[model samples]
Target: MNLLLMVTIFCVMKTIRGISLQKSTSHTFEMQEKRFVRSLVNQARLLSDWTEWSACNATICGIVGVQERYRNCSIAGEISVHLTICGQELHQAKPCEMPCITNQAVSLGSWNNWGSCSVSCGRGGVQTRQRDCLQILCTERFLQQRNCIGQNTCPQWSQWQEWSECSRSCGMGGVKIRERSCQVRRNTRVTQVVVNDILKRVSSPRQSSIQNVNASLCEGGDEVAEDAFPCMTSSSCRRNWSSWQPWSSCSATCGTGFSSGSRVCSGRIGSSCLGRPARYRRCYSPPCWSSWSGYTPCSISCGTGGGYRTRRRECRGTSTRVPQYMTCRGSNAERELCNTETCPVWGQWSRFDKCSKTCGSGRKMRTRTCVSGICRGRKFDVVSCNYQPCPYWSQWSSYTCCSVTCGPNGTKERTRACRHGGYRRAPFMNSCVGEWREQTNCSMHPCNVTPPSVFDTFECGVRNRRQTNNFSSSLLRIFGGQQSGPHGWPWQASWQYKNCNRCSWSHFCGATLVAPRWVIIAAHCIEESAQSMNHDNPGDLWSIVVGMHRFNEDGERYFIRRAIVHPNYIYRDVTDADIALVELRSEVPLTTEVVPVCLPQFSQPTVNETCFITGWGYTGPASSVSSRLSTTLLEAEVPIMNFTACQMLSPLYQEHLNSTNHMCAGDPVTAATDSCLGDSGGPLTCQRPDNTWYISGVTSFGFVECGTPGHVGIYTPLISFEEWVRTTIENNTYAAC
Candidate 1:
């Protein structure tokens, strides 16, 4: 028989058949050191029908290698073995039958009839013909399959032998010898040759690897012969060649994914990406790109990245306003995009289709699309548009310019000119795209042509005959829903902005002078500084009006040099701190009309208490911004709930409130005249015992139906996170220009 020589230094090394240990170069060997054993059966009885082999009175040590010693030789399948690392057991193997051993040397055990350990004791290897007389130990058993039927004896059918010798063939979920023969059962102390083989496995040396592996193998998932187990070089068994190229650098022209750089290129599964170097995870490709450019545009190598789809397309149009999008399932195509979330003309015009946003009538706009489609890319999954409508200048390519049919109360406009009664602070929207500063004056162009500016207002305040006491009780503010003009889309604006913070009818913003050089207002009054003023520079905001309590009769028009919205201020995204500062071109001359209001040194509003709100919003809803800055005096009783209660009404908040960061207020319901239209940035002032009106929540967001109850309104508490505010303010105020 050929004497196969395994030079492994691990605990279980084997030799070729008819091979003698005396022929080996080494003698002394390390013993199998295991701390504890766990029994799967709770109790196992020694069978009287056990086949005992006649061998020397040596102990059974678990060890495997080529240069093994004889006389005191170890055996395979003699006893179950296990080891413990850290606190976890490498294997809670079967409670093994203890074998006899003397010195520290390995107490050689023998293999059964199938094991090469035994021979006749005579020239034909005599003394070993008897079932209890043969002993030849080699490499440890790599894979085993077991049946619930045979825990002790071989199955009646020879065909079942492949299924019975498992670490746990009966997998209700328990231990089983794995099929990874290349797996070296190491002991820290092994020959250099054995250690070299250990470096090839793709699995970690961690205990879980062995346990999980054994579990899979025992269930007979797959089997590898004992000869092919050690080296694991047999290409037919393993998954990839990474094991063979452990230290090799990725050379693929597509470096990360497959090893395509080789003379014989490697094939990949999906969009090719680099393989993760982690122990367990397999190599995969990257997701497809809607706009393929830079590294993102590069094509994937072999693997089907993560087994997803890649697609692309382009849009073209001439006659109608509707843009035409063409899509295809290929990485080579150009990506097309549409503005509408649900494109009626196009099916999944998303990234897979390669269309994200579309150009208007002319093919002037170029859009890099967001990934979306029926099929997934290598790294990207096929998903839908989870964002808002296309931003201004962002053509509603998908929705088509089919006359952007504004729902009812509004119309589209080419320019941003507001009529008299300029602003009651209603969101007067305007677009900047293709906005030509025409040479002709207002006489030639008129105010607006195709898409009229109906929402914009001038100085003429609408007449309402209601309450004479305050602005809120006025009848003009009570009515809403008026025709702003002809409604349509294909919106002309490349960018859009409004007169106030939001589009709602309520005039929710208030202007005040908090300092000599600062015009104070609510933080949320504006979001994107770029579009609001037709100014790309956020620092160029020019003027702000403050001091005067009413807009119908203007008292002050303060010129502003620079405006700064709170960095932390999220627009439409509400928080408890709602404060903003506008740096004026010059300091204010404090007089009755331009007097500055002081922020509270501390919080003073009690729960279930009453407070006041004032604004220039309408007494009756008008078609445009309030002609005059009107002030309405209205009452509110604090409901006195926690942030959670208030947050329940709006999802934009709740993430920024803590003990030191905001307060909750507003009556569960308020009387008819709270801050109605255009009441934003106004202070929720509570009259204190000291006769001082302390500012609490800043009038921020509320329901569209202003002044009604049950709709909890939000206020930015001046006290919460007051320190952060002060520091930020002081730091910026003292900043060197």
Candidate 2:
């Protein structure tokens, strides 16, 4: 019934009882209940198949069976609900009135009428067929049901106007992760370091014994650990590890030859430090090298022309190109092999004006070119050569080939990649092979090469557009103020000096100008030296082209003094922590665009309330990062924790999270999300009251495929080591001369 009519009926009832009905506490539910009653009545008329009772009047009472029994309600929207019974809803039951029995009325009936009493019992009902398909019976008798009379008329004229107040008490809920509980039986058990390297090292024959492995104890179950997931039970939990992930097990205890220490190693198969089977597994390759490890150089087809033969093995290179392994998935018989004498030939345009390179045999030679003088693009399938801006006439008529990338200021190639032979004589490896007729060189790389200008291509945008949307809508991103600023350009935010001229090349990832003569970046970006036509190699990758933001274009591409990734950044295993520190061939002037941000002051701001993160990642979720650097603010309130609180987050850091190694932050209650994508490896800068900024986290790691609610971006906390960053740069950096 409508709240108005119900109010009228309620009013009439109140008057009949000589009781005054007044506005009860601030009860939204009360008001909504009245609305709900009206909605139910309307839905009965408009929604259900029951046309017989379009306007039914019903009395709604709390389960207590008393008028004005409800205290009050705070939720908005309709508080009262209307039950619309369908014809199909009524036909099977014979209480015949099974759809209409009133509760008080039902209790007053006998066995024969009692079964009938349940029909539409007025509270709620159940209509079910008897064991025999032929006999249909239904009973609906909920104490909370309201009685709707015939023709849907009001029960009484005064019933609608009155309302009672109610309170919302806490529903059953609470958890506690007390300190002493999660203590990693450290004092009682053994603890050892099995998977301490960058990627969890496959267990060696000597590392298989599991005795004194002092397993790190997870201290608590009540609270979720930082970098950890909520534990479903009371046993143990760990999160945030230097190089470990947590996995679940039935026994609550890890076995020997398996990960005794609890670093839930994800994504690959293998044992932890003690050399046990992987806690959880997905790897299919044999342990050690490729199951093809016993490989011997075989002249299977031993041919002259294009036919070749070479041993196929694992080609472990760090480049954006799809790893040879990923591209060679499942082909064990036709493994990869390669010719060692292979050197990709180069073609030049105007000495070095164009950034050009070719990949063939299979893969089309994708190119990154400056359409006009601007960084836009157009590519052609041609041989390898320097990548240069197309000739002014090159709009449609002019085309050229490239072998290497050039520098903007006529400097040397910043990144030096060399593509060897594309065809692998071996089965799957991307490496070497001899010719018989032909063989896929699994070792030959660049199968899925990410060219500098690949983003400028048409198809990529279509594929990744959706991810971009998801990224934009993420709640974690909203809090970061997305504003452009006066706080100097990010490229030049570093306190160090750099020289990147955008005159000659393209295809450079990210880099930091560490000093007047040095720059730092991921080695994977410059893995290949250079390659030939119809063949792929790592060489075609950019040569540390510093200044140019757009791919395929050149600027002051600096020479690479050296590329050094932590020996551990091997792609497999827990690569979330793959970090590399690069040294540039030479530094550029510290202009407004290339200036540097100061490194974190040692030990200061060990823990702070707020921090900032910035990146050139795509504006949308799936999109590649734009050429320019953009920044966001991430302010998190962190808590100080002891050993167990820390260990339960992840076992690798029992020592780190404790007194010496690790410094942690974050709380599970806040559901703080960390840097998802587009922000990897960037600095997590903590800002203080005095305006000084300290690097707290290195955009380290997180699940590659993200989206867990409470999961946030994980960073390589800077507090763990003061001497490392300083010692590495000590003599190399000098404040502006």
Cα lDDT listed for each candidate: 0.35, 0.33
Candidate 2 regions exceeding 4 Å error are: 1-481, 486-511, 520-540, 543-559, 567-572, 575-578, 618-673, 688-690, 704-707, 730-737
Q: Give TM per candidate.
A: 0.29, 0.29
For lDDT, the strongest prediction is 1
Clashes per candidate (backbone, < 3 Å): 109, 176
Those runs of model 1 whose alpha carbons end farther than 4 Å from true positions after fitting are 1-508, 528-530, 533-542, 571-577, 618-662, 732-737
Q: In model 1, where is the ten-residue run with the lowest total lDDT?
A: 487-496
lDDT of 2 at 66: 17
Residue-level lDDT of model 2, residues 1-737, one tens digit each, is: 44455445544533422221233343432433333333333333322232232222233321122111112111123332222211112222112111333333222222221122232213334332222111132234322222332222111111122222221111111111111122222334633222221111123433422211211212111111111111113321121224444644333221112223344333312112233333453222212224455545543322223233434455332233324333333444453453433223333322223323332222224444443222322344544543322211101110111222322222111121113423324453343334312112112114365333211221110111221122332343432324323222233122112223634332223344444444444323333213211111112222444333323232355444444544434444333234455554345654433434444556545333555554433233343343223332222233333334545654444322333323334443443433434445445555555554445555544433222333334445555443455555543332111
